[model samples]
Target chain A: MSLSGLNSLYREVILDHSEHPHHKKNLKQATSKVTLKNPTCGDVINLELNLVDGKIADIGFTGEGCTISQSSASMMTDVVLGKTTEDGLEMAQIFSEMVMGQKRSAADLKKLGDAAILSSVMQFPARIKCATLCWWALRKSLGENVDD
Target chain B: MDSKFLKIRNDFPILNQKINNERLVYLDNAATSQKPQAVIDEIVRYYQNDNANTHRSVHTLGERATEEYEAARGKVQRFINAKESREIIFTQGTTDSLNLVASTYGEENISAGDEIVVSYMEHHSNLIPWQQLALRKHAILKYIELTNDGRLDMDDAQKKITDKTKVVAIAHVSNVLGVTNDIKKMAQIAHIHNAVMVIDGAQAVPNQPVDVQALDADFYAFSGHKMLGPMGIGVLYGKNNLLNKMSPYQYGGEMINFVEKYQSTWADIPWKFEAGTQNVAGAIGLGKAIDYLTEIGMQNIANYEQKLVEYALPKLLNIPEITVYGPHSPKLHNGVISFNLKGLHPHDLATALDMDGVAVRAGHHCAQPLMKYLNVVATARASFYIYNTVDDVDQLIYAIQDAKEFFKV
Candidate 1:
């Protein structure tokens, strides 16, 4: 397989984030926490989000799963941190659409960085859920509509 | 064996397919075997011509379907050497079969303080039902330990089967370890303890010819798909007396003998356990599968698979990082070889092999306790069957080598 577009999916940046995820601890002082799991493959992620002024001030996750699931959560935290709640939700929608093989115009996916690697994952249908677990957890914490 | 049997490879259409542009090398027979054209054709014929509910109506289709269903039961009875056709009951599979016994027979007979003895190498199908049965009955569940080499410690098993033991359920062969248990001896032990011996023959019956009466087993369960038949058809064989004594698992049509406003009576031994309208096409397909196995001769299939296992074992062991679980000698193990490549996750290895046209099973093998005992998160298993040749083993070896080089693991 060509490494050009897919490299970012397993990039060292993502691997590093997965190996040592940031904010991967239980936050007793956090405003919202949600546990999300991909039941089909047993990939679980526990996300604790600190929401202040309707913005994600901090986010952390801890769980055991494949590299894709772990890295997806790490990348999610990087993209969502410092973004307004509305922007976070909007970004998740675009990411979800991208993973589902929907043709999202480049403008719809702004500054997603390595998150674009997941777009290639659309060709391989099985890994789509792994790429979307973190986003689903975030949407759940934000009280946004999320299925499973 | 039928030396005149048409090229067996031709019967399995999937075997001709190419994966990553290479011919598919299927070595996941223990998980589920590839179906032959005969079995598939029979299933299709059933749906196309003889699809109807069994034992219900006076219609010709219903009578033909019922005959096919009962004929499949007879095949199971003869295959396992059960004393009578009444001893055989069709189930969903081995899992459902075990659950049937645990739910109906266990619920009826077992009481609090009773003990159930099982082995550590059991599949989850064999393990979880007893665990649930123990919980429901307030009984104790005990496991017989394995030796360092994964063989059942018969001494430990003997010690575990005590006077209070009501059930001794064990697997005929470990799906993960591939170690064949001395089920006959175990049945004798159960008899000594006055406990009902239930054998999970999911792994064994597919490979070996079984005689339940010779083994003196009280209950035996196996699935059809693993034996190259259609899915949704499984056999649960129990002694007629025991089956008659037990309650029906599900209350539904076809299993009833009579019904009144305030009273109801269940049908005879096997039908009582088969409450609902069973999988008609699946049973017919399974009957055809049994005929296929018999025509090829079980002894020949077993011998051929044993040779393949023998050829594969040493070649697999020669790999530096490869760690093969189960018996070192093929004689001690079934046709399965569960192994792990050092530093390569099973899923990654399996995916890599998929690219090379080598299909393997990469997971817990539905035996978590065995996985825990193996001290690994998961394993990649390559299981062989009669259709598999030395070339398939070579392909698996080549694929593992490629994976090692590709992943540098």
Candidate 2:
């Protein structure tokens, strides 16, 4: 059986990000920190955001998860490192919607950077949570009301 | 390969289809088995003709429904060799059955400082109910450790069950480890300590012949879905005397004999435990599944599965990157195989396998405590059943190889 279908889900960039995750460390002094877990698979993300003047000055995460989750977390930290908290939350919303198979504009998608590649995760419905877990952590750390 | 077992795949229409442009090789039977056409037909036929509330109305349909439902209980009783049909209480599933026992029997028996013994290998359904019960009563909860090879450490079991131990609950087969615990021996140990033995037969009953009476278990619980039956239907078998003494699990219609102004009397052992409208179709479907299993013969099925494990386990172990969690020898292992590839998370492996039409389970498997004990976050599991064949095993090996290559692990 050909596994060509997997090419869309596990792209080279995602694998590379998983192998060498950016900003995967414990921030010593952080204004906000949240730990989110995907109880279904025991994946945990401890996200720390150092917000100064309502902007994310530094962001880091430490967790154990699959390649998708690790890569997603890496990409998330890279994109939202210096963005304002409001923009970070907006990016989280866009990532969540994109992975849920929702349509998003190119400008909104551009804000996500490499994380937008996970839109293919909509096909693998089961792994959608793995891809969005870090974004949820970002939202929760930012004190946003994440009902979903 | 047995010719009879070879032909068993024909009975499941769902197994005949293609998945992901490849021949579907279902290896997730430990989660839930594929229902045979006979079982499906039974449910449809029940809904078409004999759909009614069981043990309630006086109409002919009600009588037929009640008869079929009770007959299903009898099938379960005979299937597990329970002493009587009254000992078989129809439940929502294994989780519901376990909770029923923990609520009724456990609640009535356990007290402060009492101890409940469970193993690290228990599924959450079996472990959490007792754990919660112990917490509610301020009792102590103890665990039986596993041997280095992933088998239950019977020596630890002996050490754990003491005079303070009120209940010794364990799984008949480990869902992740693929090792069958010696329930009979464990029951003997529990009885010696005067503690009740609750056997979680959710994994065992579907794959092997179970004789609850021979095991002398106080309570035996199993789900129907894992045995080629419908979901939302399960069995909880308690000894007649124990069941007679325990309080009713739920209070509702059909469970009460008479309701006085302030109090009420309960029905018989089985019916008293079964409250509200029952799943008549599910029960009838379970009875059909039992009939199918009986025709195939439980011993034959067990032997066939052992053969499959013997054929599959060695090849699985041959992969240098793969680390199997259970016993390496097929003699000690069963159909359920949990493994992980070095540097490749199970979720990625499972996803890659799915692309090849190889369905597997990846996660903590609802056994977080066990996952902790194994020192891993999660692992991918491939379980076998009657319809799975040598070709399916070959497909699994091929898919694992493909996954490793895809992930470069």
Candidate 3:
């Protein structure tokens, strides 16, 4: 009856971010707006990226979903806002790998910013999609084909 | 009345399993009940011996298949006490059945400025079709609010259902709130307005014996899976006169009475609605499920589950900080209790219970409007059925207490 796997999926930081999300609104006059939804579970993500000189100038989002989805959106906005498009895409890739419980080192996830708290979600296989939904959309908004 | 059935704990094979290496205590009957061996055997027997396309071929097996399918229709008619067997149409499920009525019947009769009334407690399947139908036909969609105890506000229900209302569709029971609605009164109100009443019997038919004629409902919909049958089969029972007046939902080979170079006429009531090849095995399974229920007696099953709910509610309420939703008594509600442990998120609580081999649903139960009305993101639900016992509720309480201690919530 050990929920060691489940506790990691809903860590304290994730709950805190879900309760008080940063950059959770519509960005006024933002450059790019993209919407994605997990049709399976009805988790939605709306990403508005403000681009400045090919790097992320600002970012924001608003949607409804489970705690994994909401917190992941919060942490994803914090991570990709100030980074260049290439670096942002790279960070999204690493975060995706981390959530899937892939064998990626700390250095591999060092660039994911506050989203790294979700690294333990890899162990709980069912929640990987919830943790990576926002990161997947952010990468697509930045113009890379999000195959996963 | 048989001891084998009374002591039929071993009849359900799914109950003898382990999930994540823990014994399974299934509590999601409102979502879909676990099938017994008789239902499964009926499906297997159909595919093994009598598998044939119904109502088309002239061969011996085809005739038998067609007869069995039609007999199943009669079984359904008698199960719900519908006056005519032709009024029952096989559908994909409750969602598909409700959509069929909204799309085919509602499309033709409803027009601009007309109104369709539904309650806030309706499942998404019952709500969205009418909403879309209203939007498309330039009609208005009205909602019946709830009182503090989560029962439908009868005053609000009466006030909103007026002469302009063309259809009053509501659930016979709320899956999330566990409240059994007064469909007889609702049907009376709809008739007063010259509106058709559509009943969502998905939750009600499984838990109780329903008489559509007594309710005076124009249309009633229910699914097979929730009633201890196979999935992918549901029933839409309409008053024969109304069904005869309505148009066919889909067009295909089976539903046509006559086709010519220019014009064609659809088949009779139920066949006209069932356009394609129906789910034959699923129908047989549902028929077997109905037979099983008859053997145990629906009244007895309902009484047993009500007692279980009555027993469980007090134990759940005694938990110091837990917040139980819906009516506090089983007499005021169906056999369902949705609640939230003091500080534990529903998903977390469900996961914790899963570790202890207790299964419960932890979501909005497809009634997001009710969830929003309750002002919670999600709540854990434990629904009871005939197989559940007082000891099972005790095990559930112990498991919740264990989860509470482990999570310190």
Query: Quick one: best lDDT, which candidate?
Result: 2
Residues B369-401 of candidate 2: C-alpha lDDT, one tens digit per residue: 999999999999999999999999999999999
Give the candidate order by descending DockQ: 2, 3, 1
User: Considering only chain B, what TM-score does candidate 3 achieve?
Assistant: 0.98
Encode model 1's per-residue lDDT on B1-409: one tens digit a residue: 4333326777899899987677788899998999999999999888888888888778998888888888888888888889999988899999999999999889988899999999888988999999998998899999999999899999998899999999999999889898889999999999988999999999999998899999998999999999999888899999888888888899888888999989899998878878777888888899999999998888888887787788999999899899999789878877988998886657657767877888898778887788778777678899988778777888888888877765556
Candidate 1 local distance difference test against the native: 0.84
Query: What's model 2's overall lDDT?
Result: 0.93
Docking verdict class for candidate 2: high
Single out the weakest 10-residue window by summed lDDT for candidate 1 chain B: B1-10
Cα lDDT tens digits for candidate 3, B1-409: 3343346667888888887676677888888999998898889899899989999989989998999999999999999999989989999899999999999889999999999999999999999999999999999999999999899999999999999999999999888888999999999999999999999999999989899999999999999999889999999999988889989999887999999999999998889999888998899899999998888888888887787888899899999878889898768967878999976667667777877778898877887778888888678999987677776787788889888876666
lDDT of model 2 at position B182:
95
Positional deviation of residue B363's Cα in model 2 after best superposition, in angstroms: 0.4
TM-score of chain B of each: 0.97, 0.99, 0.98
- Model 3 segments more than 4 A misplaced: A2-67, A70-81, A101-107, A113-119, A140-148, B1-6
Considering the true interface contacts (CA pairs under 8 Å between chains A and B), give the fraction that model 1 also has. 0.00
The per-prediction i-RMS, to one decimal, reads 4.5, 0.6, 3.4
Greater DockQ among 1 and 2 belongs to: 2
Displacement of the residue B10 alpha carbon in candidate 1, Å: 1.4
